[model samples]
Target: MFTEISADEHDRQLELHGPLTAAVRRLVEAGISTGADSETIRQAQLAVEAIAETLEQQRHDGPRTMRHAVTGRPVVLADPVIGVRNAIAPPLTVQHTESGRCWTEFTLGAPYEGPPGRVHGGICALVLDHILGEVASDGLRQPRFTGTLTLKYLRATPLGRLRAEAWVERIEGIKAFARGQILDDEGVTVEAEGIFIAPAWAREAG
Candidate 1:
C-alpha cells in the first residue's frame, strides 16, 4: 500500500528541508577541504557523532515512496534526485515541457567537482541516465529500467550552473529509446543515448 500524506504537511516538510540539506552539503564540503589540526579534527568528529545520534533518535522505521497523483511526480520531500531533504542530490529542478521533453536546471558545486573545476564525467553520465530513463518511462506511467547508456563528452562541463534536457526518440515493444544532452553556458558539453526496458512487472502496471 502507498503511504498517504497531507499536501499541507508535505509542503511544510519541504520548507524545513532546504536549509537542512544545505547544511549537510556545507558539512561535506568543509570536511573535504578543511586543513585543520588534529585537535580540531577530533572536535569536528564529536560534533558529527552528536548530530548522527540526534537524527538516529527519530529515524523512519522503513523505506516509503510517496507520489503526487496530479503531477505524476514523487512528493518533493521523499524524492532522491531532487528532494530538498536528500543530501546526495545536486537537487535539480526538473520540469516537463508541453512538447514532450524533460528539462532540469541546476549547478554542481565543490562537492561534485573533478579535474580542478569541471564536473566529473561519471556524474554527467549518471545524470543523463536518470533523465533519459525518465523520458523513456513516460512520466512514470510506464516505468523502465535503463538497459544501456552511452555518453560522449563533447567538452568539459564546468562546475557551475548547467542544464539537462531529454526526450523520447522511439519505442518498440518493451524497449524505449531516448536521448539527452547537458549544456553549459557556452554550449552542449555532453550527449547521451539510452535504451530503457520495461520489465514484466512494469508492463503489467501499464
Candidate 2:
C-alpha cells in the first residue's frame, strides 16, 4: 500500500529536491560528454568520492516498499523511466486528467539516444509499459502487475521532447486492459496495448 504524506510536506520535498537533482543531472551529462585532461578527471573523481562519503555518513535505512520518498506515491524514485531523482530517467512527468487519461511528456537527452539522434526502440517500449501499467492500476488506486505488453513501432522517435498518452480500455475482475501511444514532433511513433493483473497481495488488501 502507498504511504500517506501531507501535500504541504510533499511540496516542500519537491522544493528542496529541484536544485539538487538538477545539479546531479547536469553532472551526469557532463560526465557522459566530457573530454577532460587526466588531471581534471582525477579532480572530478575526487569530488565524486567526497560527495559519496558525505552521503554514506548521513545514510539511514529507508522504507522497504517502493514509494516516492517525498510524495509517498506508489512510483519508485529509483525507476529509470519516471523517477524524479533518477539521472538516467527522461524524467517523464505524468498528468492524470479527469477524463480518465494519463498524459506524459519529457525530453530525452544524449544518454537515451540510439540509432544516431533517435530514441531507442527499447526505451520507447519501456515508457509505454510504465504508462500503460499506470492506466491499468487506475492511477495506483488498485495496484497491478504487468501481465503482457505489446508494442508496435511506427517510426523512429526523435531524441528530443516526446509525449505519450494512455487510458484503460476495459476491466474484468482483477484484470485491466490498456492502450497507449508515444509521439514526437512529427506524430505518433509507437503504439501499445497491455494486460495487467492485480497481484495476490493487492487483491487481498482490496
Count of residue pairs whose backbone atoms collide, per candidate: 0, 0
For each candidate, what is the lDDT? 0.83, 0.81
Over the stretch 2-30, how does candidate 1's per-residue lDDT look in tens digits?
45556775677677768888799789889
* Candidate maximizing lDDT: 1
Tens digits of lDDT, candidate 2, 31-146: 87899999999999999999979977975365423554554467455677766556677777788899889999888887777899998889998899989887788776678889
Question: TM-score for model 1?
Answer: 0.89
- Please give the TM-score that candidate 2 achieves against the real structure: 0.89
Clash pairs for candidate 2: none
TM per prediction = 0.89, 0.89
**For model 2, what is the alpha-carbon lDDT of residue 135?**
77
Q: Which pairs of residues collide in model 1?
A: none
